[model samples]
Target: GQTPLAAGIAFAQKYNGTGEVTVCYLGDGAVNQGAFHESLNLAALWKLPVIYVIENNEYAMGTHQSRSSAGYPLVKRADGYDMAGITANGNDIDDVREKMWDAVQLARTESLPSLVEVKTYRYRGHSMSDPGNYRTKEEIAERKKESEPISLFKERLYKEKALTEKEYEEIEKEAVMEAEDAIAFAESSPEPEVATVFEDIFAPEDHCPGRPDRGVSSSDRKLAMAVLTMREALNQALSEEMERDERVILMGEEVAEYQGAYKVSSGLLQKFGAKRVLDTPISESGFSGLGVGAAMQGLRPVVEFMTWSFSMVAYDQIVNNAGAIRYMSGGQYSIPIVFRGSSGAGLQVGATHSHTPENWYANVPALTVITPAFPDDAKGLLKSAIRSNNPVCFIENEKLYGFKDEVPEGELLTTIGKARIRREGSQVTLIANSASTHVALASALQLEADGISAEVIDLRTIKPLDIPAILGSVAKTNRVVIVEENKPFAGWGAQVAFEIQNRSFDDLDAPIERVTGLDVPQPYARVLEQAVMPSAERVTEAAKKTLS
Candidate 1:
């Protein structure tokens, strides 16, 4: 299993030997992901000079650091990884720049990762929708007046004569204009071609197994043939890919020391050393965007989340930078990056950690979302994901971490967009993914017991769905139940349910039934949590209802 910090360490190790230093800026909240720990351990172990920039913005969404963390301060935590630490006022641009420059230089010279804590303040609420009532208004006012970064930067720029008042104002104006131009251009540009919805789902048709050097030595040995879990497979794939290409790296919280929240990067730290395996603070949006910027400079970074529920913190980066950059740049650049991790509800993880992000991201024409169900698929899919020229979301399942399945030692690689038939039958079609695919298969089993043959298909790649497979299945079965772990409203399941109803109106025996997570947010209580998501029994019933 891969922990969050291992994500950051991966990249640090990859870029360690190069002249450029890789920096991951994260917030106080992000330090909690399990991967964050293992990453630092690996970074220190290998001495792969990486800078861990912590933008300690005090609060982690609704919770304050005083409430969530017991700390002397974050930079000291870096010592646990045997790394050097620097703490400075985040609002002071001079201090921030000085500290960061020092950290970068130290990393380059030492080939070791260091943590730099910038005690900054976030002026806005976590996001546009945050009501922000947790902190007192007085506290907000005080922080705004005393520690505003931009304001402090302006004062320093003026006092130090870094630029004249008139020049500073002009620079601000240009920044505003540049931001506005990007928004305007995005709004006016044509979206990706619909037919190409099928494009980039896989490598250029030429990159598949037929090419001997598409990846690794064809003779890496088919060992035990099956002692690995999906997490192991994913870890191996990442390690192999990162080793094969100097440009490839990894970033996020716990990729190194903790091995991974699920232990996905168990042996990677030993294999690649520290500079490539880095740790980040708790800022999802910040580090994700940083990964995007690094990619722009020709580094391949794998940004892992302890789980995908945290991606809400970086929806903008995923959509704007990773997804839109190539197209927005008129195809002048490519995003050789992977934002990979677990997704969906499991182990009673409440509302905050249970989001199924497929539907939200599915709408973004510039990104690719991949959901794999088994070990072999996870490994093969992730390898392909890292190799991708575009930003790729390698979404995984916390619940499925231990799920085992046989994988080929050689050429059984699966591509994005392609759908797999988990099982086959004729009476009806059950289309689903992630957890739902498991439910659907169980439902199919129950259907068999009841004499209603059903076909089970896992739409492994959520975006660039295998629509043709879906259409053909529905055409033959005349009945459908789209299953998903998200709420029914606008979740990817609804998209399929509605699209199918419209496209195959006359070929139906019953309306499309959606077996999905309940509309309520996932609950924290074990019993209540189970009550929120779709289940084997519920799916089986839905399939039976369609037959009726």
Candidate 2:
């Protein structure tokens, strides 16, 4: 998981003009992972200053390297990427240092990545429980006698007359005493309180109460409103942030040169230059992990995927690395990164390309999930996400990118974790987000003609759900209808419905109804796509059912 992060760290070093080199270490087994290959490819393609050290200890757990690996010499793997490959005798500390020095120099001076295969052997079993059943005891003893690191180094020092035997003995005794003292200190320490289990899950900045100022001055509001598409609005936000902060960068497939897959990053590369606006290869795991690493280095990286469906390839980087780094690091690191891309159904891109993963990301604890419905919300929420100290998953809708609306002049930043009431009523509350918000508004109009007033609530942010706003609306309407474009089972709507029933069960006059995408893969056919996704008619029927 941390393998790809090295490439990202190296990228930040280059971007910041630090001329620093990052050295990453991985076991022999980790080289077989997809992320390893992706990271190396990206590092080589970008000529990042990094060195990947693969410690080939001859075995992955109980399995021998000969059986697990196909290649003759592990160092040859570097040839695939045209990277420098070298091998070192790990048993000799001097030899290992000499080989690594060359790799480090290549990275620092030439700005190139190198693969160093350190051939080593572990005499003991893989773990404490293992009984050395994989190999014979005689083989282990023979290897230890020939190349034990500590004994070999001591012998070398003795031959050079650098140390006496008495000195070596004293050093060993001191190390043993230090280890015992550390153990005694740990034994004397008190157990942590049960209440501390939830401590340090997120940075203090993430827990900051209330959203940033979303109010525009009365004089600025008098200026003419700009009618821009969602793509233009998002582009403006990215440009503004990059101009405000030099640490902010945007990278993705087609984000530069080609502008954007949806023209969202138009004119950014030309304006910010290639250093800040990067066009990455189609390796989501690599670039996403790189973004995580960059964020760890204090650079605010906004990584874009061609589509949300493609983000599944980089799920480990997003969910594991970016989502848990702050908590796992005991709050020492803050992953202030934003992952933004198009999502939801309506693109008719088939099952592989169409995916609404707001619920998937919202389930993560340290992630801020935002699904913007209108262009203004997309621009404002995206700006807020960029400034957030926590990782944010900004889900956009391809269907709404071209939809134009009035955006106030001057700085516009919407408050996250706050829902916007699109329409107010008393009959029932229609809760939705992203594209579904438009459907809910249309359904509200249809219900109005039938004498049923429906309140439309656009939940701009999925996580940190505005429960207070939801309860307030439910208290007035006494009925609820949740609308979303996700699949039926355990979808975003399901969580919203559960929250409403759990908190306002007695306030509801009728059972809560949900209108969600059908439980099936998105189809390529236009009619099937329409039938599979939530529509205005479906939302209207669900709202009517709640009223009934």
Candidate 3:
């Protein structure tokens, strides 16, 4: 779940048969989630006078409905639930409204969930880079010609003389003018003032939900195990934060139902209740949009995408809406939202799943990116992320979640824009983040076997990277290697290299080097996946290259 579409459904169902109605509009792709099935089953069993509107655009990315789903016209899936279902032409507003009217009538009369599928085609590609190799441009153009909903409605309105030529011209002019006005307004809006920086991370203690467990200090006996592993420290952090802030709601698919796919959110729902610990209908776009909306409204939403790769479906909300809101709204609103999950290679998750989002999101201007390698850093960075007033992408390594570390107790927060010195040495600086940080430290040990005193710096934050640490080390050591489990071109390491070169070109003894994942996508085979990302051997090799 991206935000709380299921919560919305629950809200709608709560009002069913009371002369109130709830309608949810979702893309055809959302049906692929297991949560959708659960929601459908719940709606069916409860007979929650709800209308499920699926905006079936025929394709989920390049994977068409036929390939991604076994069912045709997905509405018919309601047959299993014994609910009434109908398909409508989404391009026709009249058709949609008419079917909606009928669906509502049926739900009201029978107190049952009604499925309405609206067939439409997105005029644009999924997210701008789609080459349309999956579907021919001619086919897309034909779909556009036949199914351009807004224009289709306009045509219908004009042919019936519901609007004369002059009126139609007036309508077109008005729409264009309004769109132009919005664009101008957005552009002319002043940039956020410096004071606005600390505005929206969380509601003030008085306004926010739950009083801080002013009592639970690092000494809480139950949290002693936190000293054993960074994973336990993270669990303790979640417990303390949740106990401290009632309004800090956790939502995502399986976060509640399955105790989080990674066990980070285990037993959260039992403690927080469904209101705060929501389980979403695996509609990433819908739910993530809902979280964006909820954050804008007031709630401190911690949205967990199982994997950053899955975030591909909701990139628009993350980049366009969340990143642009404070500036777009003239600092009148701040989005106190956090999106976290695993990234990079952990196993044979393959090309589709094993991706590091460092370059993808770090390039965005407004986002705060945090990727911690060790457990202590993870707990501290995650706490900082949760407390910060800006949107954050808190990335964790799939391999390191269970790694152990001695985390200092107390209300500890490792500052956002600072780097950690993992090992102090004068030979060379090995800068790394997330899973690569450990590899850097291990290689530092391995390099010690040779006579190189390697210095390792854990760059906790990617966006506001601890440049001073990097430059200071580079000035002293005069050589550096940036490592990560991501592709080389336009990757995070590239940006780091660019920044260092521009700022400290005079300090380097030799050219900076970066050890990163292969240029190709990670393969499904274990050996291939291992080969795709940087290893300790590769880090050591790259370090030696700089030394040589």
Candidate 4:
């Protein structure tokens, strides 16, 4: 996974004019991964200063390279990209150093990518558990005598009159003593306490506490309001953040010159220039990993996927790298990056293009998941997400891009874990977020026409849910209905329902009901798509059922 990050690390070096080169090492087996090719192509195309070293150790675990790889010389693969390729004998220390120095010079001076394959052999099994039964002992002894790195280096030193047999023996004795001292220290150290296991799982919360008023003050009433669409509001947030912080950068496929696939980044490239606003190739894994590396190197990056559905290709980078890096590195690094793009199923883009992944992303620990329903919330929450210390998944709805609302004229930053009470009632509580919040509001209107009064709560953030607000609503209404675009099985609503049951089960007048999308792939046909998604009518019915 880290192999895909070299391009991004090198990109930061180039962006900051650091004049540094990144050297990324990989096994021969790693070349088969899609991320490897995607990263290499991106590094080559961008002319990022990076050297990819492929250590072809003859065997990948138990299988020989001949059984797995297709090509004879792995170094030649770099020629396909019109990049420099070099090969060296890994067993010879001088040869390896001289070849690598050439690659390093090419990268630092030319700012170009190169592939250097070092042909080597492993003496021991892949791990200590396995015996060396794959090859004969004779073959192993022959390699040790003819091509062992340390032995060959010692012979070279002897021929050059740089060392004697006595000095070599003394160095070996010192090495053994150092290893023994390290083992002794480990054996004498006490075991870690059980409480330490929970430490460093996440960085301390850096953002301000959740403001119950949603950053709206009495003084803000005097401020002028502008009617803007969701797309415009989001664009304003990105522009403001980039201007405020020089470290902020925006990158994605078609985000620069093409002005975003949905026009969310219409004029940013011209304003920020190509250095701050970059357009990348259609390689999600490569660019996503690059964003993570840049964030690790102290740059604030906003990585836009063409759509959240396309982010599936970069799940390893998002989940394993971005989400887990803080814990894995023991809180030594902060991944302050935002992954934002349109999501949901209203468009006729078919099942492959439509995915409501809020539930899937929220399941991961150490990730902030936000789904804003209106233009104002979109602007405010996005600004906060850009400033957050944790990795954030900002899920937007394509259908709601053009929906207009009143956004404040000045700076507005909303808290990440707060919910807004859209409407007030006592008969039943209707909870929803993102596109479903509109459905819930419509359902509330319909319920009001009848005798039943319904309260609408728009959950602006999914993870770190505002449970206090929800419990207060549930206690007042004594009945609850959750509405969401996610499918019914193990959906986001299910988690909300569980929390309500666990915390306020005694206040319930009837069983809690959920209005969710049907458990099926979204269809391309307009009629079928509408049928598969959660509708206002379905939400109304669920609210009525909860009251009954």
RMSD of every prediction: 9.4, 2.4, 8.7, 1.9
Q: Candidate 2 has what TM-score?
A: 0.96
Off by over 4 Å in 1: 1-206, 209-227
Candidate 4, residues 284-390: lDDT per residue as tens digits?
99999999988887788999999999999999999999999888888898888999998999879999889999988998988899999999889999999998878
Q: Pick the candidate with the highest lDDT.
A: 4
lDDT of 1 by residue, 1-548 (tens): 12222333434344543455666677788777544654565557656556767788888998988887877687788878778989989878777778888887787676667888888877779999999999788988998898788877888878888868888789889999999999999999999788865544322323462223222122223443665677777877887788788777776778788777778878777788765666666767657765776676667889888888899877777887677767656666677789988888868777788777888788888678888877777887888777777778888988888887666564445566777777777878888887778888888888899898988888888887777778778888898888888887878877787778778888888988888888887889988888877887887888888877
Kindly give the stretch of ten consecutive residues in candidate 2 with the minimal lDDT sum.
Answer: 210-219
lDDT of 3 by residue, 1-548 (tens): 32234433333344322455567677888887755665566567545666778889888887888888888869988898788889998888877889998998877676667888998887678887888778887887888787777778777878888877788788889999999999999999999798977664333322221113211112123433345455566666676777887657787778887888888887778887776776776667656765675676556678889888898887877887677777666677677778988777858887888888967888787888988877766776677677766788888778887788766667656567677777888989999988888889889998999889999888878887878878888888999999877888888788889889999999888888899888887888887777777888999998899889
Which ranking of candidates, highest TM-score first? 4, 2, 3, 1
Q: Rank by lDDT, highest first.
A: 4, 2, 3, 1
| TM-score list, all predictions | 0.65, 0.96, 0.67, 0.96
lDDT of 3 at 247: 50
Model 2 segments more than 4 A misplaced: 206-224
Residue 244: error of model 4 in Å?
0.6
lDDT of each: 0.75, 0.88, 0.75, 0.89
